[model samples]
Target: MPCAPTLAHYWLAETLRLREALWGPLEDSGEVRRARAQGQGFGQKVLLRAQFLGQREKLDLLIARWTRGARLALLGMLAAAILAGAATAVGALGDGSRSVNVLLALTAMLGLNALAFLFWLLSFAVRSAGSGTWLGELWLWLTRKLARGPDAALAPRALVEVLSRNNALRWILGGISHGLWAAALLSMLLSLLAVLSARRYGFNWETTLLSADTFVSLTAFLGWLPSLLGFAIPPEAVVRASNGLQALPETAQALWSSWLIGCVATYGLLPRMLCLVLSLLMARRNLAAIGLDENLPGYAELRGRLAPPSEKAGIDGPDTPGFQAHFRPRAPAPHDQTQPLLAGIELAPDTPWPPAGLPAGVADLGIIDSRLERKNLLERFQRQPPGQLLMVCDAQQTPDRGTIALLAELAGLAGQAHIALHGQAGAGFSDARAAAWQERLAAAGFLPGQLHAGLAPALAWLAAGQPARPIAKDAHVQP
Candidate 1:
C-alpha cells in the first residue's frame, strides 16, 4: 500500500532526529537576526533558519497545511485521468486511422506533461505558503498539543534557524533514489504481465510446447519415461532449480525489454549521489558560517563532547533569554519604510567581502612573533590593557613609539580588549573588523583557548602588562 499518513509523519520525524544527532539543530533567534544584519543572502538566511528550527517541525507544518484535503486533490486527479481516457476513446471512435491517431498520441504525451506540471506547481505553492510566519504559528500550536516526549527535543545545530535551511541537496538525492527503485520495479512488473498475455495467446506454431524427445519406442515407454524422470529427482530440487532458472530468464527479459530503465538507473543515481555528497559539504559550510570550526581543528573536530573553543570565540552572546526560540518572518513593508539594516554592505550582485588578513600584533604572543618582526614596539603597549589601547587607537591616527608600523601601533592599543563578534558579514576584514573576530582568529590557526597554543598566552600576557615577543613569518598562518 501507499505510505499511510501516520507512517510518513513518523518517518519524517525520525529522519530529522537522525540529522540532529549528527549535526545539531540550527540556532533560531539571535543568530538569524545577526546573520541578516551582517548581509547574508536570502538562501543563506533560509538555510540558517532551517538549522535553527530543525526540519521536522517545518516539514510537518508544511505538509499538514499544504496537503490538507489531499483526498479531495486525489479525486481531482482521478477525474482528470477519467476525462483523459474518455477523450482518447472519443477520438479513436471518430477517426482511429489518421487525425484521431495523431490527436491521441499528442494528447497522451502532452496531457501527462501538463498534469505533472500542474501537480508540481500546486505542491510548490503549498509548501511555500506553509513557510515563514505561518509555519512558526503552526509549530507552536503543535508543540503545545504534542506533549514533550524524550524524542521530541532534537539536538540543534548552532547555525540553522529554520526548516528551510536543511540541506536541499540531500532531500533531492533521497527522492531520486526512491523514484528510481519504484519506477524500475513497476516497469519490470508491467513487462512481465505483457509477456504472460502474449504467451497465453499461444506461441508461433513452429515453437515446441515443451519436450524435444526423439524416442522411437512405443507409447508404453513414454508413460514410463515421466515416472522414471520424476522419481530420479527430489520434488523440491526440481521446483527450486526450475524457479531459479525461470528467474534468470525473466530478469534478462525485463532488462532487454526497456533501455529507459537502464538509462534512468544510471543517470538518476548521479544526482542522488551528488546530493549525498552535497549534504556533507553543506554541513561543513554551515558550521563554518557560524564560526564553530575556528574553535576546533578541522570540521571533524565538532564530533565529540570536547569543551567549546572559548566564551570569546563562540557564537552565543551573554544573553540566555534568546536561546531555543525559532525564526519568524519580518513584518510587511510599510509606507516610507526604512531600508534593510545591511543596505550599505551591497551583499548581492557584488559581495563586499574584504580579504582575510590579520592586523599586526592583534595578539602579542609568540604567535605573531612567529609571523612578523615586532622590533621594540611590543614594550609601548604592555603598560595598558588591549581594551583601553584599542579605544584610544580608534581615535588616533599615529603614535611615536619604536616603529610607525601599523602592527606595532595596533598591538600596543588592544592589549586586553574583550569583544563579542556576532552577525555574519558578506565580506572579510581584520579579525576585529569581521563579524566574529575571536572565532575567525581561531579558524585562522590562532588557538584562542589552547593553553599550549602561544597566541592566547601572548594576548593574556599583553593584557597583564607584559611585553610581547618579536614577530616572525610563518606559512601556516595564511588561510
Candidate 2:
C-alpha cells in the first residue's frame, strides 16, 4: 500500500491547525476573497484563502484534489517499467543462447537492485538536516507545478519551509522508489514466463576461466537462502552438467530454468516486495513525526497573536472590516530620561557606523553583525541594557527571517525598543520596499511602523524614549 495520500493529508491537517493558531485563519468572507483575488501568485492566494480552512477541511480538500494526480504519477512510472521489462525479457531470449549466464542474470537484476538500495541508504545516513534530497527536489518541483495558482508564489516562506520539512515528501518518494523496482521486476518475470512458454529451451553455462566445480559450489552457495524457504537447490550433477557450448539434457535444462526463475522471484522480486511494504510502513511512521517547528523566527513570534483579545487590539481602518486585529502600543511615558544608545543590526559595511548626530550625552552602544557579536551584546546588556536602544538597519536591505529573529532577540534587552531604518532615498531603495520591511517588522512582533527612514527622527525617537512614527508612505525622509 502507498502512503502518500495518508501522510500528506495528516501533514496538511497539522499545518492547518498550526497556521490558524499562529497566524489566524482567513475567514471565508469578502475581505479574504478580495485580497486573494488581487494577489498575483499562488503563494499569495494560498496564504490569503487557506486562512479560512479548518484543519480537517483542508486535509479533505487536499486529498480530493491531489489523490488522482498521485495515482496518475504512479501509473506513468509503471508504464516506464513495462517498457524496461520488455527490453530485459528480449535480452533473455537471445537466439543462440538457450539460457542466460546465471552470474550475468544475477548481476543484471539483483546486483543492480542492491547497489541502488545501498546508495539510498547511504544518502539517508550522510545527508544533513534542512538540506533536500534529489527526490525531495523533484517532489518540491512537482508540488509547485501542481499547486500553482496565480498567487501561490506570494505564500510566506515560513509556510513553504514547513511544507518542505514535512516527512510526507520522503515517504512518497520512498514508496515511488520501491514501487518502481517492484513493478519492473514483476513485469520482467511475466515477460520471461511468456517467452519460456513459446520455446523448448536448453540451459547451458559457458565460462572461459572457471572450472565446472567452481559453478557447482557457486550455485549451492547462491541457492542456500532460497533453499531455506523451500526453493530447491540444484543437484550437483545438474549444476556440473553445464559443459561449455554442450547443452544440458532436457531434464537438467528444465531444472536450471526453474532455479533461475526461483532466484529471480526470491532474491530479486521478494526483497523489493518486502521493501515496498516497508516503505509504506515507514511512510505511516513518518506521518506521525510531521509536526511544526514553532521555534522558527516566522512561527515563533506569532505567539503574541494567540494572546487573549484586548481593547488595545489595533483595528484596521474602518474600510477593511475583518482584518486581523493588531495591538496598539502606547508610548512610554517620558520619565526615566537617561541618554539612549544606538546599535546597528548587521548594517552594510559601506554604510556609516554609529550614525552621527546623537544628543551630546547619547552613547554608541556598538554594531552587532555576527552571531558572536550578538552573544556578546546580550551578555553586556544583561548587566546594563540601554535605556532606549535604537536598533538600526539599512532600508536598502531586505528584512529576512534571520534579521527578524535577531531583532526580536535584541528587542528583549531594551528598556524600550525603537527600530530605525535609513538609505530609503539612496539608489535602489524605494518607498514600496521600505513599506514591505515595515509590514515584515510588524509581523515579527516589532512595533508597527516604528522603522525610521532618517537619522534625525531615529535619534530623536531614541532620545525621547517612545515608539517612533511610521515612515511617510509617499516620500522618502531625508537623513
Predicted structure with the largest TM-score when compared to the true one: 2
Clashes of 2: 16
Off by over 4 Å in 1: 1-59, 69-75, 95-307, 310-479
Candidate 2 lDDT, tens digit per residue, 87-160? 67657656535556766765665666677667666766675542223333444345446654333322222234
Candidate 2 segments whose C-alpha is farther than 4 A from its true place: 1-67, 95-99, 128-168, 315-479
Model 1 lDDT tens row, 140-248: 3343334233433332211122232443322332232233323433343344334433542111001134321211121123224334433121122222322222232
Q: TM-scores for all candidates?
A: 0.20, 0.51
- Evaluate all candidate structures by whole-model CA lDDT and list the values in order: 0.30, 0.60
